[model samples]
Target: MSLLQTAPTCDPDDQWCVWVSELTGNDWLAQAADWLIAKPLALLVLLIIAFVARWLLHRMIDRVTNRAAEGLPTPMLKHKPGKDVPATVLSGRRVQRAQTMGSLLKSIASIVVFTITGITALAQLGFAVGPLIASAGIVGIALGFGAQSLVTDFLSGIFMIVEDQYGVGDAVDLGEAVGTVEAVGLRVTRLRDVEGTVWYVRNGEIIRVGNQSQNWARTVVDVPVSHEQDLFRVQSVLKDVAHEVWEDEDFRSVILEEPEVWGVQDMTPDWITVRVTLKTAPLEQWGVAREMRERIKARFDHLGIELARPARVLIHRDNRAAGEDLETTGAPDGSGTPASS
Candidate 1:
């Protein structure tokens, strides 16, 4: 009975000693493991908070910017002679400028957010960012010399913005390339051609610019009437057409000034050139001119006027068979045919 009792007590003491040893060896590791599990959850929560904060900040900034621009008078909102202003849409240039500014602001905001998140993530992982920043500076300096063109482009873009050389939706001709300015940015200018192709021109390379969509555009139309038609009659017809076009539904909105007819600009044996000049709103002159041409055709056709083309009434005579009566003319040599001069 004494031996059994002694054995049980010794066994219980040994078990207790083993449990203490295990705790002493694995305590720090257990705590570290628990922290590792919780770290990911904490990071996820932080990222969610950051995302929500960024969205709210963007909305606030956008609202503030829009509110500041509310008092400005847009072209679309202005009262014109024969135009109606719709309150929903802003003017072309104003809308374009707004979009460009918004893009720039969003880009800057995203850069800021990304930078903060990256730094926070690195710091949370127990990394020293001071050395990283120092290395980044050295590398940036080293790359600066090779990236002079990029620097020039950026600087030129900023100057362009300050100077307001041109803006989106403006019809500009840059050297040999002519197109509508679709977007203007710090590094490059985007252009869209009539063919719907987009061109990217570097800002630094633009030395000459032709802006066609400025205040006004001129529509010059040349109408050719038959030489047989009376000069006064043709001029009278054009003047009437111009007056009617000024009151036209489609053209009344675009024509700022009535078209003035310059009579008999040039004369030929078969045709007389009549010139019509008009002052039209920017980018509206083409449609106005096209409409005038259609009206002119209708007017000429109604008045029984014959418009001639550039073709010579050629006299074809077989010199070898000159004595033979030219089939069309009774006279064998009646100047064979009156060749159109």
Candidate 2:
């Protein structure tokens, strides 16, 4: 103030001094200086808040996962011989589903928290956020219209996880592909089919899911025998095979109940099919069916029980000789005797 009072007024012709006087008298410069000094500190605080919120969000998700897991039954399976089976634990599918859900929650929380933090930080820097928020809303609405399929996929994925429709390691038949689920994400599910081809299926496109590894499964073994074989004998043999498989120590745990022999399911001209049904643990039906088939085949072979085989017919014709005889015998007259060559 003292220097300002002692200084002489600048001449209108002196451009440099006039410019300096205007710059020093401007109030906006000081405001800008204060803003510059405070912006970084505000931004740092916002970053800290975002990180803390992220940590809290993850912790909450972990707690929820643990509580959900607690309500589930401990999964157990027969271990290989001579190997120690671990204590009871959650099923592979359950654990994977929990983990996937936790990751999705964390990701969504981070997105929302960071977005809000960014908007707040922008407002602190003296930027108008109302227009930005309005613009974002309009853009979101436009995107919703343009990306309906994307929204459907995300919603379907969310419901799929929440309802526990299918999870990793579960075998499912999605109208287009039948395979084991390898990964389930927000947009798509990855499956590996029997041929080992990995398939990426959009969640919205899966209208129906046939989960084969849930609860229990039925092992159906169809044994076809020749029509010549007695139906009663075949039924008896199949019953014996089923009983043996059920009683076997190696497969005992997989078999939930005694196997049933549904006698004479179908009869064709050449064969009669007998059905053997076994109730087995989830995912064990295939192995049980295969083992039952092998055992039945061996038993049939040992007992000389004939399986249905394709019938072949042979036809013999002497067209050339018959034509020659007809030509020699025809002479515009009826003749009962054969013509001499």
Candidate 3:
């Protein structure tokens, strides 16, 4: 009875339907044949729709990825006029990010496209879909609890990408690790420190991020002078030194603006600290600071500037009245007596 159940509507005049009914001498057998033929046609339609949707989504992803790779203008970051993008300045990190994002999006599209098609096709084939979806939801919840950390990592990585928190080649401080990011993934981020030690930090474990290579950096130099030196004179000399560096052809490219001399950063009995600061392109701070130090040393030496030095005190003690005996090992007679202070 179940096998002979009624099929969906079919014309009595259909040649195949009629042929099947006559050959088998049963109406139900002909209806079953018609149902079988229709199922394949429906499945073929679903397959075509799925493939088209996937292809369209993949193309969109590729377009966006290519734009990002070329440094497309964003609200936060705009490309400057007349500056070519990434000829020599093009780095591997940007390309990698684009590729990774593209691949992830494509994979997700494929999964969604195939999943929907499969569920719909199953329903068309007369299988009950409600129970299967319900069971899938329960299984999903169980997996969510069992693999909470993995899900957290995946969600965190997605947010980071969407928010543009940090990327490869960026110097960041990620709580337990501080270094240059070498690779970024949905689960872990790889970093290489100054000592060339690589660190793998979990994306879920990152609480806060300190990105040092975002836009610009500042170079700070503190010049310590003898406390007795004239504050005005020291500041003037420092300003001259800073301006001199800024004017240099080699430094002009990196320096963003005029250097500022912040007078009297700190004052102690021994020395007065004069702080100078310069704004430079990202990651250029160290090189500019080194240049500033070298130039300051040379200029200070040329002008005979007095630098602060540690003070030394000498004490004289007479031990004749003390109960302790004084000994002088250097008694010209090769004696073992200890020397006097």
Candidate 4:
């Protein structure tokens, strides 16, 4: 008889037939078919959910950034008498900070979500995830011990972002590197120097930072003139130059205050250095200084104010064939020569 028809070998009163029939029933095939189709669908659904979550997270971050940016006070809206922070700079910093925070959040969320998804997918594939998790923990500990510097870098970067130490587009001097910040990340900072060279600096390595574009800057101009020039005249000319620059419509907004002419910073044999100081908006000092120099040169040239020049003096010695007495006297050219007593 066929195997299917020979099932009466077991007693009808016994439970063995019932158990064997159940084991061989269509129910197991249905369950197998369902699992064969459902597991992959479940994994796919999970991945889709992860993608959606990431998108939503980024959307939320963008919303927060826009709201925060809107709340920032414009320079014209709130004019605090000595506060030099520009509205544009503040807005830029806010956006940069928000982006940095968003990147960090997204990175962390992706790690967690992907890790969970992977574990779940593995479990669906009939793998023991508990042992895997334990092994991952051990590996993580070993990596942590081996990559202490990396940990320190991430920690430092977090604090740096939180404290707003520096941001992209800011000119910073980070002890070892001086350049404009191009990007700030959890482990590294990218910079572009004046020479167009790019640098990647570890966040942990930056102990101190000098931000040149913050708030305000001072433009210092040292003009050297012939020592014999009238000091008061030079001072008056410098003051005039400062006043002109301050009142100019193009530069009026950049200059914060009237220029101060600090007279006679130093006196050398050939030149007297007069110091001119001006308080200007951040990043404006260089342009202002250059313009001031050009204007001052024109003014000096127009007024015939002589600048310092190198001077040379010569000494003449005379020798007679016989033992003759020699007398010397100072000449107008600062030279000494034999002369009649």
The top-ranked prediction according to TM-score is 2
Q: Write the per-residue lDDT of candidate 4 for residues 174-258, one digit (tens) a residue.
A: 9888999999888999999999999999998998999876657789999989878999999999999999999999998888877
Q: Choose 1 or 4, whichever is better by TM-score.
A: 4
Name the TM-score of candidate 4: 0.71
- Look at candidate 4 and tell me the lDDT of residue 157: 95
| Candidate 1 RMSD to the real structure | 11.5
Which residue segments of model 3 deviate by more than 4 Å?
1-45, 64-104, 124-126, 313-341
Error of 2 at 249 (Å): 3.4
lDDT of 1 by residue, 1-341 (tens): 66433332212333333343356544344335434654465567768877887798788657644643453544322223223322222245444555555566667787888778777777655589889878988988877888888988888887776445678777889985689998888999999888888899998888888887655677889887766778788888888988898888877767777679987788766567889888777787788888889988998899887675543334456567444423332232233343222
TM-score for each prediction? 0.59, 0.74, 0.72, 0.71
lDDT of 3 by residue, 11-99 (tens): 67566768887788777777778678866888999999999999999998888887767778543322343242323233444555677
Task: Give every collision pair in model 3.
Answer: 327-338, 329-337, 329-338
Runs in model 1 lying further than 4 Å from the true structure: 1-49, 64-90, 155-170, 181-186, 190-198, 214-216, 221-240, 257-277, 294-341
lDDT of 4 at 131: 97
* TM-score, structure 1 vs. true: 0.59
Q: Per-residue lDDT tens digits of candidate 2, residues 1-341?
A: 67545556654654444555577863344344445554677789999989999899889877776645544432221112112221222245456667777777888898999999999998976689999999999999999999999999999999998777888888999999999999988899999999999999999999999999765678998887888898888889999999999999999888878889888888776678889999887789999999998998999999999888644333334568554422133222232334333
Sorting all predicted structures by TM-score, with the top scorer first, yields 2, 3, 4, 1
lDDT-superior candidate, 3 or 4: 3
